[model samples]
Target: MDDDGVVPLSGGVMKAVRLHQYEVRPLVEDVPEPVITHPFDVVVRVGGAGLCRTDLHIVEGQWAAKSNVALPYTLGHENAGWVHAVGSAVEHVQVGDAVILHPLATCGFCRACRAGDDVHCEAQAFPGIDTDGGMAELIKTSARSVVKLGKGVEPAAVAALADAGLTAYHAVKKAVPLLHPGTTCVVMGAGGLGHLGIQALRAMSATRIVVLDRNEEALALTRAWGADVTVVADGSHVATVLELTDGKGAEVVLDFVGERGAEHDSWAMTRRAGSDFVIGYGGTVDIPTIDVISTERNVVGNLVGSYNDLVELMVLAADGKVEMLTQTYPLDAVNDAMDDLDAGRLRGRGILVP
Candidate 1:
């Protein structure tokens, strides 16, 4: 560690899990605590951090070549905590404040930043992937990346909202302008991100929501979260979705699975000129040229949402309009949590409390 004499930067140490290789398990080890690197940085005492599917993919080495991260790095993006310290240049937040962390750090001078689309900032660094993350006692973050948690918002639930909920919020928000009252918005996959997507749509738009999932328990949970209809994703799912939309097809289809078959089904169930939003990261599909030009249907890819979108989502959660279903585990039981997530044994999102 550096001898800077800063309260939160110097002589700070913590424990975290580090990934060494693809398809390999992470090892929990003691590491130097994160420190404020910039004048606008703030140090946070993490209360809870979420384990997302993307973390699983990273362990499987799917994104190893694409991301700039190296071995022996911490892995966690969804995080919430109490402010432990702040840099001299920071003013939006102070010590002892409860806040939610946004994983992506974007350069405010980029063209995307100028347009208020910082999610696609030309220079972007992702915590947990591109850099160290919050699977620790304390983590450092930029003030712009920290959103204050409103009163009565549970820290664990807010951790789940960081990436999964924010991603769903951005994907669903894109299609909300087209989803009029009484129109159908079909969401494929009712798991982690999909479940939150259902709740975000319910809180943001007036459209009738339909959720599709292969698991019966997941479907039931979707229904409990305000989904108007839940359909099992069998081969006939397209027919069922179209029939529910009065044979005109759904106005907007959000595919969170991004599997080959699910993509095909989403295309078939969408109306002629409707939009198909793909939010998940894995899997590849073949899109025919004729289907794109003749029908005028649009296929859009979404990344995580901007900082403003995250703040708005927090407001909805603060108002009790959206419920974040989550299960907690001690930081030492991280391997068990990963196994449960991979086996689909967990009913809701899993969070690690350090």
Candidate 2:
């Protein structure tokens, strides 16, 4: 151990869930402890890390072409922890402070970054996908990626807020400008992201929020989170949406499941001149050219939010405007957590604690 009481990476080891290949299960084994390699870097002793569907896709190698990550990498994006140690140059955070890890590292000099759209920076590194992440006892990250946790929020629940809640918050905020007192906002897929999407919309806008999900339990949870109406996935889903919107269709549709069917439904649920925001990462779609030209509907892809947005979300969480629903598992139960998430057996979100 070093003077700061952090185990030195040169000789110490920590357990991490590592993916060796595509379509194979990640193996939890002893790995070299991550070290602070940059002047602004800090090492965090992870308290909890949330499992996401994107981790599943990465484990299955579905994103290899787009992400360009190599095999045998650690996988986890949503994480919160206590600071174990910090480099000399790190100032905002110190050892022993509790913080939530922001997974995206954006180049601050990019055009999009200068315009306050750091999520779309020309150079971006996403933890768990592009680099090693916090599905372990300790993870190394830059000071810029750490956000101090507020009082009264449990670390395990806040773990889900790092990604699932923050992503949904960003998507909902984008639609806020379009939402009016009488307008309807449709949220498709009421699982992890969609559930939070419902809460974020309710907290940030006055639009009539409608939630759609194939699972009855998920729909019930959505209603519990302040959704005005809930519609189960079925042949008559579009009809139900049309009825809810009084045959005009929703003014904004946030598709939390980007599967082909969900994308089609999002388009079908939107009003003629409405906006459709795609935030999920599962499948693709092939919309007909006529559909775009005739309806004049706008489709936008939402990446995860910026660090600033995450800070704003933390404030909302601190103020109790947003609530995080999560189930906890010890680090050894990571596989079970992933299985529950994959099977849709979890009611809310799943977090792995170390």
Q: Model 1 over residues 95-154: C-alpha lDDT tens digits?
A: 988899988877788899889898888988888888888887887777879998887665
Candidates' TM-scores? 0.95, 0.95
Q: Lowest-lDDT window of 10 residues in candidate 1?
A: 1-10
**Residue 180 in candidate 1 has what lDDT?**
88
Model 1 scores a C-alpha lDDT of 0.86
lDDT of 2 by residue, 37-136 (tens): 5666788999899989988888778888987888788888999989998876789888988999888777678899899887788987887888888999
Superposition error at 226 for model 2 (Å): 1.2
What C-alpha lDDT does candidate 2 achieve relative to the native structure?
0.86
**Which residue pairs collide in model 2, if any?**
none
lDDT of each: 0.86, 0.86
User: Which pairs of residues collide in model 1?
Assistant: none
